[model samples]
Target: MAARDPGASVPVRAAVARQAVEWLVELQSGEAGDATRAAVQQWRAAHPEHERAWQHIAAVNARWRGAAVPSPLAHAVLLDTPAVPARPLPRRAAAKTVAALLCAGGGAWLAHQATPWREWRADARTGTGQRRTIVLADGSQVSLNSGSAVDVRFSAGERRLRLVSGDILVSTARDRAARPFIVATAEGELRPLGTRFAVRQHAGSSRVDVFEGAVAIRPRDAGQAPPRVLQAGQQARFSAAAVADTRPADGDSVAWADGMLVASGMRLADFLAELGRHRHGRLGCDAAVADLRVSGSYPLADTGRILDTLRATLPVEIHFITRYWVSVRPARR
Candidate 1:
């Protein structure tokens, strides 16, 4: 771990905050090694806030590290396997079912790793940098993006998910006609009465953006709570201490699942701040030039080229402190 630059000013800390997002992005793409641990240690030592940021990231991963790699919905779809009945499944049979779904390992061992056997049949998920789509036995499709996790449990009452982290886009397939689909996050739960929607969990809160159809949100800890319903072209942000916040839904917000970043006349700083989530190194801007605005569709697959394009079009500079560390500042002023 490296020591913090004692003389570093506030701007430097801001730059690091931006860099930290990128580090998190990279860490998700692969396993964090010794170098990563050292970097985290150094970031933690830099300032108290850095430690908080790192802990938030670490906490998200810790939640899923040992959890079972869920079997994809594809099993029930492509394979034409019937839904595991809602009734209590025998332990040995359930293990086989889970193992069959993951295909990488056996279910018995994984079942042992999950906590609270009751929640065992509950929904299971993967974490950041992971993408998976499952077709439920009933034909619904679920596609999850990186840094996201979820647990699923379907019964006569509802199709539920405990969203651990990240995001998911779901298009319900015809299931038993009327069983509602619900997704729960720290902030609240989204129950889609209609067919398609996306749910994302972040910073102890959750956001629901519906592209088509309607969904209802209920905070997990609330008793007899009246859930707020959202229809197409609408979005909602929910948290523990706050009532659900609803607003117009932006079509572009869900573009990341397709590996695209659609920025609509966004500030250069803000765009970079978002881009930092997909790149591996630091991304900073000259404080003087940070306010410049940018608009376009950038491919998340080539973040380096995205930076290069920024340099060509804007009056800004890109600095690479290391292959994994980059900083954007004023054009070498």
Candidate 2:
């Protein structure tokens, strides 16, 4: 290793930067296992820039530590090591860092919460508060949700999409070339059976809701286990190991495509969390009012109005701490 110049930062591709951030997120999640740590080591060794990006964070965090920053929040965020903090930063913290990286010299697009850093490098993407419908070379339609991304790869033999992050509703178009339409995610693979369906990805799992036809789901690590087939109106959530039992698909799953957030007695915290995905920065709920139930078909385009409606109906106050940070709490007496 050579002593790097302080003035010249290494040019890091968005792809490599994303991998670094992903490792950081898992490390900060406080739930990383031994396998995860080993995987992180292998990833760092896989490329020189991988190590550079990683050391960049570690060095920055080290500088923060040496500065003796007294704030607990600062320490929690700056401690990027395997040593877990008393209160680890949420996954959103990693998301925020990746968002910044996307904006840093890459001409990449920053995404909303719940999106993986890899989305920055995706072939097609939708940003915070944005949705798009993409027609594939095979004529298939992919309707991206807020903060979604996908990469398309088509050849004479196959038509495939790699889901980088977030969620999408796919409407398959018959291919003149007789190519199979497949979608790959970090957790597994999906082969649609002439269908319309929605796919959503999170940290360790993937979910699919089938609307018109059937879909076959094979977990990434389920080497010998049979892939589950989901029929119309069915849904399932699966991880690398196995698939959960299929259930009737919730009609509201696709409501976002219609610019609606349909909540049926959802917790106030959960509702705001979903709504937060459409907005930038932090949206939190104090524990005192977190479990309050909410039901509505609110227009997603008007989250501000939705908050006003909540303020009117529920016994809660909307605190606008800043333009970027909002919280729901028990109304002061």
- Model number with the top lDDT: 2
CA-RMSD of model 1: 13.2
Kindly report which residue stretches of model 1 are placed more than 4 angstroms away from their true locations once superposed.
Answer: 1-130, 241-245
The C-alpha TM-scores of every prediction are 0.63, 0.69
The TM-score between candidate 1 and the true structure equals: 0.63
What are the lDDT figures for the candidates, one per model?
Answer: 0.60, 0.75
lDDT of 2 by residue, 1-333 (tens): 432322125566544555566566666566765556666666666668777766655544444444433233333335433545576556665556534533442221222222445575578987677888988877789999987899999988989999988899999999987889999988999999899999998778999999999999999999988889999999999999999988899879689999999999999989987898787545779999999999989998878999999999999999975554578999989
Residue pairs of candidate 2 with colliding backbone atoms: none
Q: Quick one: best TM-score, which candidate? A: 2
> What TM-score would you give candidate 2 relative to the actual structure?
0.69
lDDT computed for candidate 2: 0.75
Separate clash counts for every candidate: 13, 0
- lDDT tens digits by residue: candidate 1, 64-159: 335552222222212223333334334334444333332333223223323222222335443323356877766778887654556777788777
Model 2 poorest ten-residue lDDT run: 105-114
